[model samples]
Target: MTLRVYLFVFKSRGYIHIVNIFNQMSSDGVTKYKYEYIIVGAGTAGQTIAAGLPSKDVLILEAGGYTTSLLDIPILTPILQKSDFDWSYETVPQPNSCLGLRQQRSRWPMGKGYGGSQILNNMIWNVGHHEDYRGWFSPEEDYNYERDILPYFRESEAEHQPTILKHRTKLAEAFMNATKEYGYDDSFKVPHLTQRNGKRWNMAHENHENNLSHHLVLNAFVMHLLFDRTSINRVTGLVYEKNGFEFEILATKGVILSAGAIGTPLILLSSGIGPKKELINTTVTFRKDLPVGHNLQDHVTTGLDLILLNDTLGMRPWEVFTLNSFYQYFVNGDGPLTMNGCEVVGFLNSTNKSKNWDLGFMVLPIGASADAGIHFKQILNIKDNTWSQYFDPLTSQQSVSILPILLHPKSRGQITLKDDVILIDPKYLTHEDDVDLIVTGIRIIEQLIEMPSMRRLGAELNPKPFPGCENYEFASNAYWKCYVRHLTLTAFHPVGTCKMGSSDDQSSVVNREFQVIGIENLFVVDASVMPNLPSGNPNAAVAMLAKKFLSVLLQSHREKPTNYDI
Candidate 1:
């Protein structure tokens, strides 16, 4: 059955500002300043949860406004980054990686608009292997993957049928064949994406007639949680700023933090619910101190390192802008515009173990150098010297790139606040093991290029040695390691900040049920709650989490009906 997916429809009476809500009074003459549940951050999880519950009893407070139609195109995902729709966050300069980027800081573009990071993502619907989620819970836990997780994934797939790329480039086809040649029998295939008829299909798109339409409040920046007056430990509601006006709204039953990994931890720290050492300097009154922002993890890749120059069969940047292509896109929803940057996905086992898909190769049909330092070079934050010296000669060339993403990195980092500034530090490749794995991945790609499928396309590697690694012998282990250090980039899959674990786990901020460890009536359900980074894109997994949590929420409401009273 195709699931009923709701869109964010902005109607005249649908949205209510904090000032307007103040005017709404109860029949008893008291101001109606309450809801049964208040969900912070109307991103992926917020939208999913709000749509599942009774709309009248729920409210979604999103900091950013709604998105535009122009942003709905699948191929336009690249341009959306660093734009107004993006939060445009940058990490603290990494000592070991991101050496090729400008300022030595990796750019982290999170979605600021309605759909959240879904707006900025490649629309890749990768749920990852079952073992990834199965390991999230302790062995003694009652969580079953078939009963709990798989249903949501199936439901999501039914709702948004993955768009097929009928005009996939020859290079993309060869990538799959190469994967099979490399002994990954299960890895040769096109990636499933959250798109329909070549356009992006997110929760914010077009089905707003549902109950969730009226409950959403755009531009409502949640400042802090409003604790219950009688018991300071339990949260009742929150104070949010909208149009420079701060207003308080109460949630009688629960206040859920659906903000992404970075936003969730930042909010917790500001509300004095994180490590006391980090909160000591802040003005927020100390509440329940937990390790909120520790254990930060993200999937880092050797950015566009395996450059494939296929002269006969690849798409160039200029070729995508023709009038015919635009007409085909708008009229038929089938054209060059339908190309999601990473058209094909292949997995490899770095440890040479069967069924352990540790390294993922996200095959991009167009190389960053194919644009000649115009569009992709700037978007990826490649350094001026690197672009001019290495990629300028390959302007508008027919090329492909198979980026090696470290599925699970041993390296860890933390997010902390210094004087209210959100300090993001995802220390990419700090561990020696992560470097070794990436080097192994590069070796696999090198082998894939030599396969008959790739060789038939006249595929050749870009021999330009990276700017800082010119001294080392080309393609040596030492040179590739240096290349990885210089060109490392994030896949933008940040998670595990507010880790969910058993009560005995000291590092846990949330319990197995997603409730804050020490705080009642407060829950966190987003990427922040993930204990480990999944093997692939996390959007689908997060949606499944919301669905799983929705069942838990409904059961709670049924068991204790009076708790939901506003």
Candidate 2:
């Protein structure tokens, strides 16, 4: 076999010829590189875009490394949190919420490695409600749920369709029955999981291991984009760190930032491309004065307090370590380990009308007390005093938790750069309307526990008064609001920090084509570009958005070949 080595000089338009790597020498004996396209953050969106584009000309830079087989198990999701695979970020203290959590700060865990959050997230597959797409674009824009969005969702799933649970627990079935008995008609159903053959699956896992390995660079943490010295409004390439050495690489066509809601903004802010005031006194020069980290929103859930003492309908926490469970999982790919604890999901309207779902219910087969306050309490950062006074006495109890989640919270928070550290404050439950919705959800849960389907299984709300809110009368709105304040936690679906909107819309960072409004060759394709949070888990929607962006990008190239030529 003969080795063929070729080199090309990059131009303002595009490359002269295609080569795997372009090398340039400087006085320091350092090598430089360039690519047709450079995508930052090899997470869900980054992998999706890479899979669609020509892999040979594209390059992916991931801050973290690859994942192992042990972390791929669906049941091992919670253990992945705070681990090496997780970014393990935390929010600044909130005065209105997280009163019962340690230090009053909410723990924010974003994935760090190859698959990004998909490597650690509970692999639930949901496309979100159709109404969530309304008004996202202008009337003239050729984008809508049926015309553009739905087809992309279908196209993204064409290769790897979402898998249904083969072996569901008793508690999941009971929650389904309870929804029916509570007067909702056939609206609630089992969630589709992002799994194949009872194991976790995502595009990042498939493409990286099989096809895109040549294009990916793991353990490469992107520092900031390198702006063209002549034109500050344009980005030519980016600088990244790997093995404690900084490397600069150029992109001829464009650079995409799929660095997630938190990572993307942190990158832009570090590069001095944020609000005018935020970039002042920073080390880097300001390029674009836009709202880089404002309009932060997330899905916060209440009703962790809604516990059911169901002796006949709960999964034993220790059963996962049993021989039979392991045998069944390894042999037939069916067992308790296949389930991600969240076996049942339901959508409901707080007004009791059959219009749209504003509240979502996720039923776990076990409660916080199931593990005797070991995993759940630690993962959620529940206060020590709250755990001892409230949940410790009921240790190892067979119980179920029906968590009520707010789909569209009016309350908004922000992510800001303070002293070089990313300060995240979701401002959960800052709006009184958000509080009323949780109370409404709690009342629905009250009605649900009384249903014949739940009652037959000995389902009853745990009567323990929450540690911080004992002064108010039990079951009163005042008590429930206080409970909402203390027990509310993020559903892990944060969006809108870099919102997408029309050019006139001041809150928007990117336009309809996923390009940043004020900059050229800079695009954002992640949950951060969402104008509003999707009505459910955002992973599927993120996948769909990636698919749609691929089409839009390809179309833009076809319309203007010279601009995108490689």
Candidate 3:
């Protein structure tokens, strides 16, 4: 394919960012070549596509650097959140919940490097139940959980032991027993994650050591897609900033935006692909009048922590911090560090709600003591002592957390432009129905704690409500409402900002095929294209989209035989 490239060198802030063409050769000072495919954002979703394509013809651009050894162990997931491995996104002040947090902002930890959230997530792998995808406008379109998504899930999963849950604490056992008694399901299973032999296996592993993709560019930030802006608005390539320099690369076939939900809309808006009124203030020229950043949704959550009345119930906090604990994991992958913090989860319908509004219960082995809560507060970006209500005094006692994830929130939020920076407002629990569900979920957790099995383990609610909700009678529905309003946190599963629908859908940015409407040779393959957030974590769902995107895009590019008629 004929190609054109222009390298622009510049400096931003105090660092240098250089942009380079994938086909640029070291032997020649100047080289010009067009890539067959350009995949923006080298996260988990992008790697799924890159791994299947011919290595030399594809080029992937990632914003973060390489993966570090710290990510190899599942337990170190939290430590990587604020480190350079993370994108370090902080939300604007939420007027609704987290009232006692320092600035009322929630810290969103997105992985900046290769694996994306795979590098920072709890690593519990699930594509969600088939029912979660049953009610879509067209079940065959993208919501085929059993027929489509689950196949890809099985392909990528490795089932080896030295299993993730090596040390099943008393706390986890109690939660599982509660699920059993409550009859949420007949059997309880530990979390399924992308791991092998007790170590974290991320998406980058698909492309790095394999010859599936030729060019992998890290520390590369995509600015926007380049389009002709003619009648059809055909996309040609993209402009990116690498190191301290800016450059543009041409695509022969197409460019796919696999940037996560937040990153996808930012690039779209910056490229003038969103509602024109929002882009009027930006310098980038308008390209498409699609509702790019609308319909943003996420899984919102709140939790109940119980300081075990049984001192001998689990390992003590001091025992958890000692050197022997470290030895247990490092020397033998068989201790606290052997597992992801969330080893078990339960799915249930909230009281008086349909199965559509499901609730997820995840067990946290660490309690809210100063030592344990520090990790959570830093990750949640909670500044004040509001979370202190959940903590027990730093004594011999150990605690565990049972939090509920709000599935299918009717509440709608958005990712928009605040000046040039992306603005996120999840608008958690804005709907009365959503609040009802969360309150119901909290009640469910309470019931589980009171069950014969869980009660035997010393699980009891703190009667004193959080500080902000003290005006209401403690443990009443009103009190729980206030408590939920102040303590709400995201499950970190955001989707549907750039929605996918048929071409006539005024609100959809992309069509059922995942191609950006009103534009040619450009598509979005990440969570942004989800019509609705999946019932569980969206990582597996996003990977399914990548598979479909690759299959369709490549099939269209296949050459016709000379004997065939036009």
Candidate 2: segments with Cα more than 4 A from true spot? 1-32, 140-143, 312-314, 352-355, 563-566
lDDT of 1 by residue, 442-476 (tens): 88888888888888887777788889999999999
True-vs-predicted CA distance for residue 195, candidate 1, Å:
1.0
Model 1 residue pairs with clashes? 7-207
Best by TM-score: 2
| Alpha-carbon RMSD, candidate 1 | 6.8
Give candidate 3's error at residue 440 in angstroms.
0.7
Whole-model lDDT per candidate: 0.77, 0.78, 0.70
Q: What is the lDDT of residue 490 in candidate 3?
A: 77
Better of 1 and 3 by TM-score: 1
* C-alpha RMSD for every candidate: 6.8, 9.7, 8.2
Q: Model 1, poorest ten-residue lDDT window? A: 1-10
Tens digits of per-residue lDDT, candidate 2, 1-566, equal: 00110111112012211110121111121233978789998877888898887546788888776666655767767766766567888888989999999999898888987888888787788877887776565443454678857888898777458888766876667768888877788667888888877888888777856766446777677889988877788888899987668899998888999999999999999888889887887776788888989889888886663675646442555556567877877888888778887887878777755345789888887777655655578778899999898877776566667888898898999999877888998998899999899788888888888888777778888788898899999889999999989987988988888888887778889888998888888999999998888887998888888888998888887888635422
Q: Which 10-residue window of candidate 2 scores lowest in summed lDDT?
A: 1-10
**Candidate 3 deviates by what RMSD?**
8.2
Q: Can you write out model 3's per-residue Cα lDDT over 1-566, one digit (the tens) per residue?
A: 00110010012111211112221221211034467778888777788877766436788888876654545767656667666667777777888776656687777778777777787787777667676655333544455666655655555453211134566677777777777788767434677766655667667865565655357677778998787645448888888886567878878667889889899999989888899887887776877798988898988887635334454533433444457767876677667656777768766655544545377777877654424454556677655566555453433355566777788888898888867889888777678888888888788877778878787877777555677878899888999888888777878888898898778879888987778998877888898888887876788777767776666656655743111110
Instruction: Look at candidate 1 and tell me the lDDT of residue 456.
Output: 86
Write the number of the candidate with greater TM-score, choosing between 2 and 3: 2
What TM-score, over all chains together, does every model reach? 0.91, 0.92, 0.87
